[model samples]
Target: MDIGVGFEITYAARRAQRLSNVVLAKARTHTAESIDCER
Candidate 1:
């Protein structure tokens, strides 16, 4: 039971990491677009 719980936690952490990376990438793209519009 403990092992199963640990596995779930690790999976969740990995998923969260991936989601944050995607969000960061989107934010960067949006920022670049806004900068281009200003010019």
Candidate 2:
């Protein structure tokens, strides 16, 4: 039971990391586009 709970927590952390990475990528892309537009 403890192992299962630990696995669940690790899985959740990995998923959250992936989500944050995606959000960072999107924000970077948006910033680049805005800068290009300004030029």
Query: Against the true structure, what is each candidate's TM-score?
Result: 0.93, 0.95
Candidate 1 residue 16 C-alpha distance from true site, Å: 0.4
> How much lDDT does candidate 1 score?
0.99
Query: Runs in model 2 with CA error above 4 Å?
Result: none
Number of the top-ranking candidate, with TM-score as the measure: 2
| Model 2: per-residue Cα lDDT at residue 3 | 95
**In candidate 2, where is summed lDDT lowest over 10 consecutive residues?**
1-10
Encode model 2's per-residue lDDT on 7-39: one tens digit a residue: 999999999999999999999999999999999
Instruction: Please give the RMSD of candidate 1 to the true structure.
Output: 1.1
